[model samples]
Target: MSEALWQPSASVELLKQRSEIISKIRHFFYQRQVMEVDTPALSQACVSDIHLHSFCTTLSGPAAPKTMPLYLQTSPEFHMKRLLAAGSGCIYQIAKAFRNEEAGRYHNPEFTMLEWYRVGYNHFALMDEMEQLLELVLGCGSCERLSYRQAFERHLGFNPLEAEHVQFMVAAKELGVADLVAKEPERDTILQLLFSLGVEPHIAQQRPCFVYHFPASQAALAKISSTDPQVAERFELYYKGIELANGFHELTDAQEQAERFANDQAYRKVNGLAEAELDQRFLAGLAAGLPACAGVALGIDRLLMLAFGQTHIQQVQSFSIERA
Candidate 1:
């Protein structure tokens, strides 16, 4: 290994900037009367989402018959929701989150995540708050809100909501990722492919972007819009082509949450992927009734990258996995 491997990825100045930004975040939340909370990083179960690879560890103690798997959280969302269910009104956390499969320019296996929930706020209101928070953290910038369908039409000239499955196949062939087509991609997967390839790189850098109203099929923990039923009241914020945050109008129904978990497990099986155990405590919290709320998980590293005008997340992190 080279000497560079032992050094921090971030410069001293960048580290200072990161510290300052975190301070600013705390003060901002403090002024808003939002309580800062800490939750355990380890859990008995992990999310079943096929795309998320949670880091797992074995836990053994005097009360345990055998070692059982405990997963490093992908986000504080589940436990945070549990708190919300327990009447911890508005709360925020800046905590370390992990995923096993990520180590890249924009992703680190272990990174800081800034997540928060606001009771009685829908996703649209949360999107407004996201824009306001980014403005506070990154200095003022114009905010632009667009529906997911609008983004698809603007970038690729098609209505993703109304498109036939074959249309995505045609696009797949044209984009030169025919292997994706051969595997028979689902609706959301195809949209994600096209969006990541064609639109994400080209999203407006002139202003912060908040894209809302995703297809219901892609709504992880979001509530489907009762008004539309075809769309989820969710949003994602992007700045300078970098995704900063994902927010949702929280899903409260235990049965529906269980169904989504089952669907994710089924999808994992079909794709030959690992199936993680569901967080039953989290679902139980839902059954106990979570307040009508909205929550967002923001990538602190990504936001730091923007603050320092660095293109890669590593520049804002003390040490990326590559260096660690």
Candidate 2:
């Protein structure tokens, strides 16, 4: 083994800057009366999102009950929501999140996440606050905005929400990513490819842009928009084509949340992914009446990378996966 592999991935100077940035983030929330909160990094239940893979471990010892399985949280959103149900209003957390994904220029198996919820705020309001934070830390002006349909129309010359699966496939072929799209494509899957390949590169690369009102099928935890039943109240922020944050006008309906979880589990089963237990506690929190709110999870490392003009996520982390 090379001895140099043990050294930190980030320089001392970069780490110092990272600390200052974190401090600024905390202060930003503090001024807004958003309380800082903490939650355990491990849980008995993992996210049901098919796009994410959680790291799992088994407990073994005198206190363990026959090697019970535990999962490293992908984000603190679930526990934070429970706190919201318990009346912890307007809270935030800077947490360590784990995903069983490959380490890359923008990704690592473990990374920092800044997640927060604002009571009584919808997705748009949360977006306003998110942009304000970026302005404070990265010295950015007001962000650009686009709806999901507008983005597709402007760049791909079609409206994604109104397009059929076949249209998406055709777009994929034209974009030279037909093989990347599934042979028997799911509309959402094809749309994701189209956005990643065709649309994202063309949207607000010079500044932060919020693309919102996503198709209902891809809503995840967001509420279906009452104004447009075909779309959800969710939005994502991007800068320089790097996705920075995802926020939702949270779905407070316990039954609807359960159905979404079931749908995700079904997709996992069909795709041969590992099974994850449903987070009943989170659902119960919803049933107990969670406040109307919007929440977002931002990639701290990615934000810092953009702030410091670094190209790689490792440059901002004290140690990358290789060193860790």
Candidate 3:
């Protein structure tokens, strides 16, 4: 007989590891004096990024307006930053986040995100702490740090930040993914495609790698370097060719942040994507002088998959979406 739909794909032992790792994570933060925080799962404002799709629900109870739309958080970033603005120092959260997407080997619609921030830390400093966390959390050995330009030059034979049109097309042709290069796209878009198709699959073959100094266009909330204005102080962690986390030296300029949000909303509108609530509260927090900090969000389920020596995310999750 076919297995019952209510059954979980993950074994009991895997569930045990999930619990143990969560305990260890809390201890890890506790030892560092980083306070564990909790934030609302649903909110009036949501991520405005064009790439992320947030799940939404209509409120029906007395606690909220009738039929008011509440978007499930994709991450606890905005709320955490607000806390920073309120003078809360160095906080972390093991949060449940939702994103609208297809189920696959590596993805599920809802997942656990372990997010943290460090007051007065740069992206590089955060990366160092992350390496230590990996050693504790995943028993990872050794780490390699590579700048965006270095990685591109080594893998694709081009400097991503300075590549002009002709150079971009040449690199694409060299990588045998010329067709994957979108038509007349932005410079960063082409660079991103090349990174994903050419470089990413070959990264961190034996050791965790921290790729840093991304192009400013791809910074997200990261701060652009004062010395190198074209580069953003952002980094992503990879292990065994798997992207595990992303961190940034956050941008604290309120006016610049407002402009970036407006730009993202405009981009969403132009691309025919639904616009999220503008997160005015988050903007207000920025105006209130948020602390200088670096923050990261790590995928807990993916980390568990690595810890359990599993090939698919389902093998580590208690229940896949289909089972739920």
lDDT top scorer: 2
Candidate 2 residue lDDT tens string, 63-179: 796888899999999999999999999999999999999889999999999999999999999999998999988998999999999999998888898887667778888898777
Tell me the tens digit of each residue's lDDT in model 1 across 131-231: 77888888857688889989888877788888987777676777787688568547777789888876676675788888899999989999999998888
User: Candidate 1: lDDT over CA atoms?
Assistant: 0.88
Give the worst 10-residue stretch by lDDT in candidate 3.
177-186
Estimate, for each residue in 32-62, the C-alpha lDDT of model 3 and write its tens digit.
9999999999888889887788998888778
TM-scores for all candidates: the values are 0.95, 0.98, 0.96
Angstrom error of the Cα, residue 198, model 1: value is 2.2
Off by over 4 Å in 2: 180-182
Instruction: Give lDDT: candidate 2, residue 195.
Output: 94
Model 3 TM: 0.96
Return whichever of 1 and 2 wins on TM-score: 2
Give the CA lDDT, 0 to 100, for residue 277 in model 2. 81
The most accurate candidate by TM-score is: 2
